[model samples]
Target: MEITAEEMKKSIEKIYERLDEVSPVDFDCGKLCGEVCCKDLEGEGELALYLLPGEELMYEESDEFELYYIDSSEIKYPHSWKGQIYLVKCVNPPRCDRSIRPIQCRTFPLIPHITKNGEFHLIFDETEFPYECPIVRDHIKLNHDFLKVTYEIWMKLITNPLVYDLIDMDSRMRDNRKTNYEIVV
Candidate 1:
């Protein structure tokens, strides 16, 4: 990994600080959809959350997760991504401690995007998720603070070249396919 463990630790801490302050909405979004996003839906394979490059450092001591290492070359990843990345599955999704959830969990329903002009924005995650998210499905208004902080953290995260390439590659693909993701900010 190009990022040192120390850098990953610092980034994890900073991201948590920003996201811990707000949620997608004032109420529990899960209540509306029975925590669907956190579970394995009816025929879809088991849900797995892929950690961002270097994000595995945050779970070095945690035993609550099942981690799988996948070679980027063997999978569909950004061309810039070489070597492997971590894919984490929470053993007990609904009951896992929210305070220690992974970065992917915290950023759900919102995804990072970088425009061709080199700008950062947040959008409703339009990927083929196993379960539906009411917030995205219903066009619910997210907490403004949540949008602001998530965008800010993503801007910082994209400073890492691999991270930038990953988001940029996804953004370009989405554009090419003309997926209409709502621009939240």
Candidate 2:
């Protein structure tokens, strides 16, 4: 079932509602690593974040993000994906509205996976990142509530086929890379 733009707006908002109050730790995790993850956006045309399919409904040209669209043919995308994918570069980082942070920003240092058998798992993000996230690098202990909410959000998000395919593709890539990261939950 393809999610409509209105439905996607509601779903993304629901995710925001659950994650708005939590952080990986009680304090600013960025300070521990000098905000490396957020600071990476400072470079000229160097950093952009990909929004999941249908997530573009949540933003507009006047928002804090400068949006760009790339043809799927020009980048590596899931076999199931077609046309262009929207990428957003944050105009302000490490200081945006915490409640409306993109899903990628909200779920940092953790990645979601659904096994072939349909079981869900949360793992320390195995994707290659441009900057070192201390939380993942040092195996930081995340707040239990943060972990729970993030896991729950991803589980819900994957019900959309496009999201599921995207996660599955990344999960397969991670498997091919043979990362030995431990599952968070």
Candidate 3:
């Protein structure tokens, strides 16, 4: 089944509306120390890149960028899928799917998400993650401004039914639960 661009647009709108239902929460971290954490998800499936809704500027509007590829040679980390171990790889860094990207990467350290009821919530990025993402530390507060941007992307996907299916989640995010401070619930 092919999803039309029109359908995608409407789905996106519905997701955005849900954002308003989230309830905001308050918390603080003393200066997060790191550069940028893109892909340290040991079990979060293949490291994919997802494009935020309307944030087309991420790729289309950009003039400078390089694609990264998955190295098949790299042994799969000791992890299991269904009941077997598999080391997922990104073979095409040149063309990372904007949709298949890991949720962590899309949300960065912000990790904002909406529930089935259109409630917005904030999550904590894995402290154990070893990536040095600058964007992560650039803004850290209970008022997750950065998270909004990322959640907006997810909102578009869910509202638009971007995947049209749940897709493969190898327990996808096991302990990856956020504190779930409602923003608009």
Candidate 4:
């Protein structure tokens, strides 16, 4: 079943609200890594985060962030995805509107994973980044509420087939490559 744009907008709003209630750690995790995720540091490629299906509705063309649309065919996304995918880059590194951050920013350090047996889990994000995330590299113990809420949000997110296919595609690739990931939830 296809989701309408309005439905997708409402769902994204609810996700942001739910995620706002918890954080990965009691203190700002960025303090440990100097917010590297948001910065395009010297010698590293420009930092950008892709918006999930229909998530581009959350933002407008602004001075703080530059939004670029790429043809889905040009990228290695799931076959289920088509048309333009939105990628946003912060114009001013590590300083932007926090309340309206993308879901990817809201759920850093943990990524949704689905096993071959079809079990959904939240695992430490193993994607290679220009700079290491302290939470992942140090194996920091995340707040229980943060983990639980993030897991619940992901469970709801995958109900959208687009999101499901994305997670499934990544999970299958990981399984095929025998990539190591530490499951958190």
RMSD of each: 1.9, 2.2, 10.0, 1.4
Give the clash count for model 4: 0
Q: Which candidate order results from sorting by TM-score in descending order? A: 4, 1, 2, 3
lDDT of 3 by residue, 1-185 (tens): 97665675555445444443332224222124321233334565544343333322223322333323333235332222122222222344424443433333434454544445445454444344444533333433434444455556554454533231221121123224533232421
What is candidate 2's lDDT per residue for 1-185, written digit by digit as tens? Answer: 76577887887788777888788898888788787666544344467789987667667633666777899889888877899898876667655555556798898878887666767799887567667788888888999989988988888888778889888887877777776768787
TM-score for all models, in order of appearance: 0.92, 0.88, 0.35, 0.95
- Candidate with better lDDT, 1 vs 3: 1
TM-score of model 2 (CA atoms): 0.88
Sorted on lDDT, best first, the list reads 4, 1, 2, 3
Indicate the TM-score of model 1: 0.92
Better of 1 and 3 by TM-score: 1
Superior by lDDT: candidate 2 or candidate 4: 4
TM-score of 3: 0.35
**Model 2 CA deviation exceeding 4 Å by range:** 1-4, 41-45
Residue 38 C-alpha lDDT in model 1:
76
Top candidate when judged by lDDT against the true structure: 4
Number of clashing residue pairs, candidate 3: 28
Single out the weakest 10-residue window by summed lDDT for candidate 2. Answer: 37-46
Better of 1 and 2 by lDDT: 1
TM-score: which is higher, 2 or 3?
Answer: 2
CA-RMSD of model 4 = 1.4
